[model samples]
Target chain A: AQSVTQLDSQVPVFEEAPVELRCNYSSSVSVYLFWYVQYPNQGLQLLLKYLSGSTLVKGINGFEAEFNKSQTSFHLRKPSVHISDTAEYFCAVSRLDSSYKLIFGSGTRLLVRP
Target chain B: EPEVTQTPSHQVTQMGQEVILRCVPISNHLYFYWYRQILGQKVEFLVSFYNNEISEKSEIFDDQFSVERPDGSNFTLKIRSTKLEDSAMYFCGGRQSSYEQYFGPGTRLTVT
Candidate 1:
């Protein structure tokens, strides 16, 4: 079985500051990686996805994540954050053979201060 | 850009009662799914539907859980004898392929 681990439960940052949310996965087989964000009381919105090809995957809202196979990590990063960026982020993984289902991380709450 | 949509954005029901959550997946999508997230927890997959049947389900989905695509467009999840623990946000998602999935706003089920 595959699983995702988000190292940080909460990350607090100031406006216009850089932020990185760490994510690691354990999967015996090859997998697809994704990052999703959820605003208060809203559904999840996709940030980025790493299916194959380039290790560096850029997403909406100026966010990006790198898929490192050797380290089994896909950490999400943003050069700068705004107060509107305060939301909960999740890291998810699905096996390449069967990508229909997803295993999600515990989630990291990004709190952006003004 | 068509997106998945769900009905009854919030529902309140008594324990031991039955609840059905409804979803309308994007048109022409081949795969459908149901997932739930408890307060302050990760989103957990419950079941996946394809060709009018279930493809995969988690241990969390037991006898109490049932999914059906009653018509051409609607996908519904029925929970029999709901418990307080069943209170959570249920999300509906659809995908044309294995790469990307579009998720609905979700239905907040509250069992008291």
Candidate 2:
């Protein structure tokens, strides 16, 4: 069975500060990784995905994540964040064979303080 | 910017009652999916539909749940009998190809 684990339940950061949300997955075979964001009272929005190619993948809103296959981790990072960046971040994984179903991690709440 | 849209931002229903959630995807999407997130829990996949039929479903999707694209434009998820445990945010998603499943604003279902 495939599963995702988000290290932090909540991350507090000041405005204009850098932030990193850690995620790890357990899977026997290769998988696809994704980052999603959900604002207050909104749906989940795709931030980025790692299917193949370079390990470093850039996503919307100046966010990026690096996929480490050896560690089975895909952590999301942002150099600078604004108050508007406060949201719930979720890391999801899907098996390469069964790509339709996404296994999501317990979301990490990003709290940006002004 | 095409996007998926779900109706009934919130719904409150009595236990054992039937509830239908509707979703409209951006034109030309070939696949549709349903997922749910209980409060303080990770989002869970329920089922996936393709070619007007169910392609895949999780264990969470049982006999009580059914999906249909009745009019070819509206994708609906029907719960035969609602339970208190069914209270959660239900999300509808659509995909044109392999990756990038676009999700809609979830419908918060509250079963009393």
Report candidate 2's interface RMSD in Å.
1.1
**Residue lDDT tens for model 2, A9-97:** 99999999999999999998789889999999999999999999999999999999999999999999999999999999999987877
Model 2 lDDT tens row, B48-74: 999988988999999999999999899
Give per-residue CA lDDT, model 1, range B1-112, as digits (tens).
Answer: 8888999999999999999999999898899989999988899999989998899999999999999999889999999999999999999988886577779999999999
Predicted candidate 1 versus true structure: per-residue lDDT over A11-95, tens digit per residue: 9999999999999999989989999999999998889999999999999999999999999999999999999999999999978
- Clash list (residue pairs), candidate 1: none
User: Which docking class does model 2 fall in?
Assistant: medium
Please state how well chain A of candidate 2 matches the true chain A, as a TM-score.
0.98
DockQ (model 2, Cα): 0.79
> Residue B39: error of model 2 in Å?
1.0
RMSD of 1: 0.9
B48, model 1: CA deviation in Å?
Answer: 0.5
Show model 2 residue runs off by greater than 4 Å: none
Q: Which residue runs of candidate 1 sit more than 4 Å off their true CA positions?
A: none
